[model samples]
Target chain A: MALTRRDILVGGVGLAGLTVSGCAGSPTTGGRPIPVQGATAPPGSPNLLVIFSDDHRADHLGITGEVPFLQTPALDTLASEGVRFDRAYVTTALCSPSRATLLTGQYASRHGVQNNLSAWTPGTPSFFDSLAAAGYRCAYIGKWHMPGDLPDLPGVERFVTFTIEEGQGVYRDCPLIVDGVQTPRPGTYVSTDLTDYALQWLEETDDGRPFCLVVAHKAVHHEFEPPDDLLGTYDDVAIDLPDEAFTYQTLLDRNVWEGTAGRLQTSYRRYCETLLGMDREIGRLLDAIEPVADNTVVVYTSDNGYSWGEHVLTGKRWAYDDNIKVPFIVRWPDGVTAPGTVSDAPVLNADIAPTLLDIAGVPIPAAMQGRSIAPLLRGEAIEWRDEVFYEYFADFPYQVPPSQAVRTDQWLYVEYDRGLAPELYDTVADPQQQVNLADDPAYAATRQELSQRLADLRREFT
Target chain B: MSAAAQSGAGAMPGEAARSGPVGSSSGRAWRIAAPAVISVVTFLAIDLLLAALVGRPWGPAYPLSMDALVLLRMGPVFFSGLIVWPVMRARGATRAQAVVGILATPLAFAIVSGWRAAAFFPPLEAAYYSTNPMVVGAIGSQVSSAGVGALVYALWRARRHRSGRPVSSGATPLPISTGWSWGPIVAIIAGTALTVFAVIWDGGQHLFYPWVLLYGSLFG
Candidate 1:
């Protein structure tokens, strides 16, 4: 008989049922799942806990010393107890595309989620599938903002997410979908509510099998709505607006270009407050998993960085450091040899999946473009890439142009489409990228070299 | 003589002699229609100029960008009533007719252009503009400014009528009046002060810092 989609789906479900039942008997085999015949992971594989935040810039953390007044004790503690990647970035600075890179361990160009409007490429191999096939239970709980309807993602046993406001879930009282069932959660803050679901899943599914939990928070993204407790937390804090942000022309330009309504200072305060709320929830999750804290690998990072009045721009998707850089913190007492160590080697969001899979003892797929940073965590002195590549496709209705960039230790080169002038900044001399050296005769050789390197990297990656 | 001509004979001297067939239905329609057309043209001209200044391409290619541009454009629509009020009053319109013409400017512009915008954009995009508090506030600001302009016009006309001076014909009349009440003056002062405050407070440190430095030099 010819097979239909329904038949395939039902057959897959039946196979999954059989697999679950087979593993049910050996749930508690020496603090790990017994190698059920074809299982890939051995005994004592660590549980994976990934807490992903939205639009969190690299310098926003209290430990970064960039934002002195912004208090983020929980993230500071996590960084102090684990490895913090000092030069972490997203290949694409938008939300959906960067998230797709995280899932597939591939660039946005390969994954086909190049913009916020694009959905995950169906049938693409994800780390979740690899981990599940290797005898690990995985649950994804939080904001799933890809454009197409919430996907029936294979290998994710529990899919708890929301689809309101085009998947940019509300900060308060966001309705959720738990295991494909509509669940209303009224008066619950989204950050707290998602963490609660993560904790609940962790508690109920503690069957001695290693698990992967992703708790993605919708805080610090648009509307800048913090919880009631943190609403006025930063109102008294003085906001030092950038020099470029002090001009009326800059304010008018940003207001029209980015659709940002209020004062940048006020919106930035609310953003910080909302981030604090998200950090509080992260602390709660950390406290809940204290029993297995030593055995659990917690990875905390944001999908992308946000530009807060940097270069007179508000919001992300630019090739600037404020937009492409993200805060990457990983904690695993069992795996990482050196705690409180910071690696200055550049890392991309695409590296996250392969790194997690490597930590879980799953073989890294050959197709994943990102390299696992397991050696860096182990304090092994290995050769790493000296520069990072960044790409941003212009999403509709946003005035930003499509651009590609390459950032090295000393220089940052950016090329724009739509006839805009390319930009080159000497990071050693001007960290804020105030002076453009693209047209300067002095840096002509540097610009040419970086441009060629960018072209080569795009060809090699794509 | 026809009834229209007979009625025109008894009308105000400036009103009957200013233009073509002043008492006819078409003339009355022109009274409202002309100002509405002028107001929409003025709005479009300003939008086009601002779009050019901002380097926004002129098309429906990007709906949200256009929506934001439209919202920003609405901030200056307050000047539409201010611009048209004098023209309507100079053309022998009474205070009621002038106010009606000024009010209908924004209403007519919104209905016509909003319909065109909706046709080109998606329903969700339209709904975003309608439901956004900032966009709603812009609309409110436009209407309130027009209302204030009408009230000012009415007060000026009342003061002129009480002083027994003939309203202008063919030339725009200044809003100057003798023995004018304090209500409109207070309202004007309060509105101007609020506008200045909003610009300074929300305009980041550009306008605010200058005022701060000035105050410090003067008093600090």
Candidate 2:
């Protein structure tokens, strides 16, 4: 195909237009991407404020119309200012694996640390360390579930840690020890105590320095006990049962921990009550950062998703949608595209690190398995990954065999070693994942393709 | 057959008697054989297996004979598979329930067993009873074994009543309540009691019958 005179003339004009615009005002990318509607902090510098929650779900929010009794005005404010990732997800569903992947920009298998049994050791080159080295002051508050042995970190000025309930620590009314002294309950609650400490840190911290503050909360983990103040708030409001809540239809063949509807409903109600408390606490933390809102980037996310009895399974060990997907929101008023636009780009916990590095103008390590979310931030056409891999190794009580999965937006392929079989679900059609299509004749092609991809992923990561 | 001939409890008359002189009961002696010896041996083997496989996992603190789950494990198989719905008539349990029961019971048993395995076997309702996986087997493994032994005694009673033609008519068989059972119960009690002394003497529960009781059920 030969270039005509008209085609050459048109190309010349377009190229000439870009050249002229580069010299004027703030030179933004011309034809490569749609100009982001929100403010872009000139070049690469922005305050990072990551507000992470545990076991919180996107659909559980009051704005989502599912959990109306809940109050999350701060998270709501962040979403109002920036894009709420309507379908963001954690690579793995368990706690440590999820956080490890987020920090290292790699899946749990590559990192070789799966559940709460193994701690995420320092010297592992977390993005936090990279940000600190790049001259950003960092502070991590709230539950450091990874490992409590905080090694000397250069840039992190504040660190708070607590083990979850049942891990040799009491959760609700128990006194929390900070720096080796058992701090008496300021009042009659543990959740408020932690929040007060975090809020105090925010107010007392030295200012004028670019900072990255991560506030991780343990509101909704287990034995769902809220502070006395928030205890009866959602009691009057009838808790909306998660769609798969009370599945009394026991498969007559498969044997498991036998539980009754009274157990499931009672637990689900308590789970929501705990979430409601966390939602209120989030509002408190947001009010803490309201003064520096312009320069700050607030991201609200959870470690992993939890299940409410879908497919007769009651917990978070499996790689089903209910357990793997979590809420991810990025609200940097100065950065991020589409003041309120949502994208279907698949994001991993690993990408959280590089995305921060990209926002902070820190170079992403070549060894990192995650690609930065920066391109998506600029509204550029990013060749984002099509599928994400996930896995979990055994932890004491959850001593199930290791499992691996490949999840596309539409399809999820998994293998449960217990059944010694592979399962495939087209989440597009069956979000409930009632039917397993791995053995279906029609899905042989799709399964084969996904299987190959899963194999390739394991090999590359291994 | 007359009551005397049918009993099979006596010997035949002396050689001086005519060919068919014994009061006729007919040739009905072939209908029976004593199942007592086999029953007790089977009983011992099952208990040993239960103790070895299920009992040891709970730990060495428990002696083999006192595991309550041994009863639970056998009761369901007995009531459902035999008595209530005889194996021939009753619906058996599914494979999954069996696996869960088999797998978890051993853990539960071992835990219960170990709490005092070194101290010897305690009754199911002892101080540690509430802490262990309670037998809820109403009458669990040990009692089930006792029941088997009692059935044997009943058979021995019926077997001894013969009176004619080498099988007697005068001797009366014993009642089920008359069997030599307290000995076995006391033997188990003694074994458990001795286990405490043994552990204290040797400083370990793993010393006694490591091969026969503990290792056999776990591996074999």
Model 2 agreement with the true structure over B32-151: per-residue lDDT tens digits: 111222223343455556435431224443322332434434343222211211110101223232223222332343443344332322333123332222222212333333334334
lDDT of 1 by residue, A1-462 (tens): 122334333322112211122222322111111122226456888888888889999999999988878988999999999999989989999989988888889988888888876667556788888898887878888877876656677667777787766677788878776665556667788887787677666655666678888898887787778889889999998887655453222234234334245566778888999999988888877877766788889999999998776666688898888888899999989868889888888999999999999998899998898989888898888989999888887564354667889999888999887667999999889987878999999989999999999999889876
Per-residue lDDT of model 2, residues A258-329, tens digit only = 212124555566667777777666666565556666777777788888666554445566788777777778
Q: TM-score for the second chain in candidate 2?
A: 0.22
lDDT of each: 0.69, 0.53
What docking grade does candidate 2 earn?
A: incorrect
Residue A354, model 1: lDDT of: 97
Model 2 / residue A392 / CA error / Å: 1.9
Indicate the residue-level lDDT of A441 in model 2.
98
TM-score of each: 0.73, 0.61
lDDT of 1 at B97: 68
